[model samples]
Target: MKIGLYVLSIVCLLLIGCGDEKDSTPLVETTNKNQKPAITSKAIEDFDYTDYALSPESEEALANWEKYQELAIQIGYLKKADLSFFNGEIEDLKKFIDQFKTETPKQLLTNSIISRTAILETMLLKLNENLTLENIDDKLKLLSVRELLVAFSNLNYQINKKLESDIFNEIQPE
Candidate 1:
């Protein structure tokens, strides 16, 4: 009982010694009234939607642009060794579409977007479909991978037309 009491006392003293002064700043209270400018007005509220007609192609192009942006983000997680060769393909695709439309046509942009999207979709399908089970060499797998890589290479030709010079100038193989 004496040892237990001594231990308890020593713990209490140690804890007290470790305590620091508490912060004493008063919290500031803010009210939104008189704090900021008004952002909306009735003058901007009555715009009619029927007068604006976006072409299907333009919509498709926009969608494809967003998709490529997502792909670019995905590529950031990929190692340069794994994706270096294909990284420019999507960029080339963007350049191609950019050149073909120069401001993608309303009707044709949609078809182009669909076609571009299909390429990624097909590539993904091929990747996911391959089941390289236990060292049985897949000739089809090699062929598909080679084909997709080549396609990506061609796409990079356009996508990274400017950056390819930089990539080639930078890579130093050991």
Candidate 2:
């Protein structure tokens, strides 16, 4: 009985140890924050992006309207990367996003518009640098897209923080 109990304890310890195993994959380093794990391209692509569901833009263009609309648009473009089955369409996505800058009311500091925007530009440049669809199997290339949900969340937080003052509480419907 003593031996059986001892073996059970050993098994329990092993199980606990296994639970703490470090993730085998490493993510690309992001300067956005110091506390959270640097999100990897693979992890990013693997994430469920529906959480940032963007609704059709309200004509009023409320304070958060830009964040919501852009997120939806960004996700649609990113799907191209996912369908490639690897990193195949990353370059195309980058080109589309890069050349897509347009002036509009909801354009916040973190949006693709405003070349001077910080986080948007950083993400643009990073996506451009990685996720190139070159020479690899189309299926294999699909894996390069990173989870943009985190990136999107970060942008929302930044936008809210920066626009707290000037942002209209709720734009009155015309």
Candidate 3:
């Protein structure tokens, strides 16, 4: 009977020793607003659209300059690489892209411009959809944003190229 008690006590002591230690320190709940993840550091590079500048001629051809301005502002937001801000601005960005695509200037209404806009629209929709899903990856969101930005830049480049071609053709001998 004494041996039995000793064995039971040893088992109890082993179980107690194997138990997880509970932290006695109370966790303070502080609301940390706008907390950025460490992975976001230097994740996106600054986009310079200066080289892709629309000539004065192309700028003047805009059916809705305000739409273009709004797009520029959104691009600025993307350049800042703030994922949360980008997620919040997705709807507004969609509106801007839709307006710009629909109201494309007559002079710049090339197949390339149309295709680029379509690509951009698709990318935005995909990103927005991913963000709505449960436990979406941040890296995936960043990649989508990058692709969308590239599509926008391509649209600008196509517009400038088209405008320059038109201008050059006008100057050539008939």
Candidate 4:
């Protein structure tokens, strides 16, 4: 009876120890802030994009670009706030952004625009990494989503600024 009890204790200890195994995936480096992460689901439409009309050349380029269409659809998914397939949507967005970075249309190839897209791509990658962690919290997920939206908005602003400048240049006396 003594030996059986000893063996049972050892088995219980082993099970407890195994239960504490840490996840292998590394966490994204975060600031040691004690504050709770805020949900920053700002509406994309709030950004003033009205003044930056795309030129006919840019419109035609976007119309013909399947990657750009895919990008827009992905953004639409994010905008919808549908949590059912949110993980898959983020994954899809990351892939589309990667492709868009390399195949930007000629009319949209300004240095600033390209730089902004690169920043957006980096944000998406970080979000993807965060999602891959085994113990992701809602705060981290929401914060990452907010960051992703901000990066995309910045890219849109750059593109619009470039288009506006191009239009202004065309109307100016040479």
Highest-TM-score candidate: 3
* Model 1 CA deviation exceeding 4 Å by range: 1-66, 73-108, 131-139, 153-174
lDDT of 3 by residue, 89-142 (tens): 566757766786777666666788788778868876776666666477767766
For model 1 the TM-score comes to 0.28
Per-residue error at 170 for model 1, in Å?
36
> What lDDT would candidate 1 get against the real structure?
0.44
For candidate 2, the per-residue lDDT at 43 reads 42
lDDT of 1 at 62: 44
Return model 1's CA RMSD, one decimal.
21.4
Write model 1 residue lDDT over 61-173, tens digit each, in one string.
Answer: 44655544444443333312243323345555455434533443343334434454456456644533442232334444444444444433343333433334435778999
TM-score of predicted model 3? 0.64
lDDT score for residue 63 of model 2: 37
lDDT of each: 0.44, 0.47, 0.70, 0.66
Using lDDT, rank the candidates from best to worst.
Answer: 3, 4, 2, 1
Candidate 4: worst-modelled 10 consecutive residues by lDDT: 44-53
- For lDDT, the strongest prediction is 3
Off by over 4 Å in 4: 1-61, 83-95
The weakest ten consecutive residues by lDDT in model 3 span 44-53
